[model samples]
Target chain A: MRVLGVDPGLTRCGVGVVEGVPGRPCTLVAYYVVHTDPEDELPLRLLHLDRSLTDLVAEHRPDAVAVERVFSQHNVRTVMGTAQASGIAVLAGARAGLPVQTYTPSEVKAAVTGSGQADKAQMTMMVTRLLRLPEPPRPADAADALALAICHVWRGGTRSKLAAAAERARGGRTR
Target chain B: MRVLGVDPGLTRCGVGVVEGVPGRPCTLVAYYVVHTDPEDELPLRLLHLDRSLTDLVAEHRPDAVAVERVFSQHNVRTVMGTAQASGIAVLAGARAGLPVQTYTPSEVKAAVTGSGQADKAQMTMMVTRLLRLPEPPRPADAADALALAICHVWRGGTRSKLAAAAERARGGRTR
Candidate 1:
């Protein structure tokens, strides 16, 4: 399955696309950061993000989209902008009829580095190893997006298997 | 000038359109709430809001859009959704090339009821009186939206005058 992961922000949004399935190494399709001018008005900045994300979804055509769930526990000043950017990312995926999922930072870290409390360096290292890249993805935001995509692919695979098992246990009934 | 006011929420987004200038009673053009199923997924809900808001902007064609500024100081559980909805509202106005302004709840209250700390009941009463409505607008959300619109009109008028004065002070040279 192909997946698009978004690390949302107002000034710089990270986007990564990967292709893979369960129990298989994911292939990096593309990764980039979407940046908006901080000097621009809020509405215009949001509009720019909305358009960029919409274009990314169209260009990638991922089966599913994964976004980093924003929390207020971080910097209070930027949390709102993060949340707003995430909403735009989710909207872009949904508008294209793709399933969108959100994962917490810990969840992505756990999925990528085998520890929920892993530090940024560990996350980057693990992502580099997992994706078989010769070098780590530059900029923490891009690496975080790649990690989220990897997490979704692995977790989504397990979830589908569990659902299939439940279906079989229920005498193959359609649910 | 006409303004479209949005009190952003996920489940029930309130929208109000009003026409007026500073120092005059505003007339309510329309008011309604856009509802999205709470059971729906986050992305779908956001998409629904985006479409609704875009349509509203197109239909109303307001000179400006006024949205309630969402703050994280409110209910933590709903703050993210409110922020997301507010982002969508801002995007709609910006996409249509209309000036969008956000007003705090206190600012709206002060503009409409002459008190920043005015309670909701007072707000509703003043909104009714200011709009010359025979009855109070139902669902506090709608009233809040109208209040925002009224505040934007008055504040925007003042802002323009101040800008003009500043320009005159600068020998009427465009900065």
Candidate 2:
């Protein structure tokens, strides 16, 4: 499965595409940090993000999308921007007819680094090794996006399999 | 000027269209409550809102749009949904190439009822009177959408005049 991971934000949205199966190691197909001017109007900033994300979806054509879920923070303004960016990400996926999944920060960390509370460096190191990259992706957001995609490729695939198995078992019992 | 006002939400998004100048009392052209199934997936729910908002904008062809700004709340989950919905509203306006403005609940209430802290009944009563409606609009969200449109028609026009005057003054001094 090819999955796109989005760490949604107004100023800088991180996107990473990964290709792999559930139990196999995933490779990074592409990654980008889409930047928008903070001085721009809110709608314009959001528009830029929207267009960039839409273009990325068109280019990669991922099977599923994974986005970082917005959580409450001390700064309500910051959280609002994050939430807005996240909404755009989800909308982009929906527009492309792709199933989009949300993963919390901890969930992505746990899936990538085997610990929910792993530090940025640790998570980066794990992603690099897992993807067999020569160097670690920088600025944390890029690496985090890769982690999200990797997490979803594994987690979502497993969940689908389990759901299918459960359905089959129920049908067998009824018959 | 024709204006579209949106009260963003997950289950029910209120939309109202009005037409008038700053000093003149605005008339409500149309209003509707866009509803989505609570059991639907998040993406589908958002897609429904996106399409409905898009259709409304295309049908009315508003000169501007007013969306309720998402504010901080004690319930993080609820606030996230509101923020997401607000983003969708803003995006819809942007996609339609209309100038989008956001008004806080207090700002809308104050503009319509002379008090920022006006209760729902007071705001509804003022909206009904302002729009010359036969009775209070059902489902408070619809009334609030009208209130937002009224606030923008009055306040946005005043702000535009002030901005234009400032520009004139600046040009005179600079030249």
Candidate 2 clashing pairs, residues 3+ apart or interchain: none
In the range A39-138, model 2's lDDT, one tens digit per residue, is 7767777878989999999999998889998887646668888888999999999889887888899999999888999998999999999999999987
CA error at residue B77 for candidate 2, angstroms: 3.4
Using all chains and alpha carbons, the TM-scores for the candidates as numbered come to 0.91, 0.92
Reference-based lDDT, residue B107, model 1: 89
Span of ten consecutive residues with least summed lDDT in model 2 chain B = B166-175
Tens-digit lDDT track of model 2 for B13-78: 999889888878999899999997887777778888999999999999998899999877736768
| lDDT per residue as tens, model 1, B1-175 | 9999999999999999999989999999999899988877798799889898999889989988999998888789889999999998999898898778888999898899999999999999999999999999999899999999999888975674576588789897321
Considering the two chains of model 2, state its CAPRI-style docking category: medium
- lDDT by residue (tens digit), candidate 1, A47-138: 88988989989998998899999987778888889989998898988889887889999999988888999999999998889899999998
How accurate locally is residue A122 in candidate 2, as Cα lDDT from 0 to 100? Answer: 96
